[model samples]
Target: MRTKVSKGKMAKLLSVVDRTWRAAGFKIVQARPKLPSLSAAAPDGCIVKFSVGGFGQVRFDAGVGAISPGRGFHVEGEEGDTFPKAPNGGPDYTPDVQDRYWSK
Candidate 1:
């Protein structure tokens, strides 16, 4: 048997996979778009965007790229995946957008 999926579905699916891998001590490092503010206008249907140090950068809905190679296996998160919800209405999705910066 075989099954088909839509572009939206595929995007969501890929997000899930990336989330799962990150949870398992693996990092999906990718560069994501910068947001001016939480209350600012976001792209249409855009859930989140971020950048990974080693995996490069990517925008889930707008751009495309390869999944960053990590020290673990390949995985992603489903729609119902358990992730911390940021308070003050940060983003309307799981896996909060975060980044690591170092400066002297």
Candidate 2:
């Protein structure tokens, strides 16, 4: 889900996610998704999910200044343990479609 993060704050937000994911040498790739028919997203930019060197996958959704749990425990890790979230919450990221075409 996306939490109205300003374009300026994108970097700061990434920094938070990057800290945890980067430590594990993982790359964050953005995807513009069109799945489940009406679920077209690219909605204010969101970090959906990524592979963990074959261990499993971790799901994510970007918030203003925090990251709330997407699921109790997704493919790899729990979303809450993975990010610092804002007191307010936001929308869920797009459906998990592996056909990722990378974006900055």
Q: Which candidate has the top score in lDDT?
A: 2
lDDT of 1 by residue, 5-80 (tens): 2333434435554565456444434522232111111233223333222222222333333445656464466344
* Model 1 stretches astray by more than 4 angstroms: 1-3, 31-104
TM-score for each model: 0.25, 0.26
Model 2 scores what on Cα lDDT? 0.36
Model 2 per-residue lDDT tens digits across residues 1-104: 22333334344444555556556554445422211111112334433442221212223433332356564445655444223343466533423323222212
**So what's the TM-score on candidate 2?**
0.26
